[model samples]
Target: MTLAGCVSTPHPEKNTTAIPVAPEPEPVRPLMYAAMPDERFPIPAVKLDQLDRRFWRREVDYQTSERPGTLIVDTPAKYLYHVTPGGRAMRYGIGVGREGFAWSGRAIVAYKRQWPRWTPPDSMVARQPSLQPYSIANGGMDPGLRNPLGARALYIHEGGKDTLYRLHGTPEAFSIGKAVSSGCIRLINQDVIHLYENVRDGSPIVVVPDPSMSNIAVSSL
Candidate 1:
């Protein structure tokens, strides 16, 4: 009967230290150079490792007096800018013409085409006889992944005369950052398609000259 009065001793309070939870990390978005299999010819994914990171498509702080929607090609810098509404630009790496082939001027995107024909000029054919098969007289090369013009072509013109130069895609993805022996201004196939979709038929374009070449600049636009 002497149960020790239920041992009236109270139990010790439990520890209640709060534990902190770590915040989740944000997802990393890979660049947009993934393969476009849905395309007519099914463009392959770009070999990003072979190209400089600067050549990748990106929006940059651009100081320009030109209106928005204008396209600016900086020859020496090897960059093309699609002037956005703000003082920014969607810059894309490009392959410029080598030596005497480099040109600078103001022009308009007179027209554009998807999977455009690759027609070598007679002079070009004369320089490279191998291209004779794709000459204008031969009705040009059929559009495809191998075509020099790649997936898209933005024809540039001034005063209604064709510059014969184009902002076009290229199969040679490695040629994006260097001056090439041919073509006016070349972009990656995916970048060119993006540019084509964003640009209008008559958007103004300015090619800033290399200091070693002409004195042209965006201010002249």
Candidate 2:
């Protein structure tokens, strides 16, 4: 029996080849600022490397008492809150005004700038004549190292006039949880970047009075 299932014949032509396909690349996000060296300054010995994340407290389910589009600076808490709808807020750590520079008022953000030029105020220049050379009329200091305004600035105005107060960034990240500014509210460069992304020109700001002083007044009564 030759068998019903037995056949062997040579077939020499068969082709098998694999094809390759490349993957699509991811889109890149543009950076807000180029990487740069830190400016020279008389920096204090604060432990910036050890950031206390606990200093920033957000009540997840709790709504802010403030209203939307209003800025609230809680000096004692060292936090600045931008009230949003539904009781939420965009909170940021800040350096508040020092004792003599503490102030409270309603103001509008008149203008904002990136890598802003800085000129010492005339009064500041008068007290420190060395700064006289850097006054605004003298073209102000060029943008770079040594400008106290840091990376960005938002000028505050009241009654259609500049109040000479500012919300600005600082290289001194360690100052984030302290009251050490001359009169302005100081934010870390990173935090200010976050804030700058959220606000627009002419945003209203309501600086609250220092709680300690308010408490003292209440106790005195």
Any runs in candidate 2 off by more than 4 Å, and if so which?
1-50, 56-65, 211-221
Best by lDDT: 1
| Residue 203 error, candidate 1, Å | 0.4
lDDT comparing candidate 2 with the true structure? 0.68
Per-model CA lDDT versus the true structure: 0.86, 0.68
Worst-scoring 10-residue span by lDDT in model 1: 212-221
Q: Per-residue lDDT for 8-87 in model 1, tens only?
A: 64546855565888886543424578789999999988877656778989999998899999999988899999999879
Clashes of 2: 2
Q: Give the per-residue lDDT of model 2 (tens digit) for 1-221.
A: 66656765445584434467677543231232223345233223223453356444243333655468677777777888877788778777788877766667777888888777888788777878888778977978866435778767889888897877788877776677887876788886655656776788888887876766432111110
User: Could you tell me the lDDT of residue 150 within candidate 2?
Assistant: 72
Which pairs clash (backbone N, Cα, C closer than 3 Å) in model 2? Answer: 63-87, 64-87
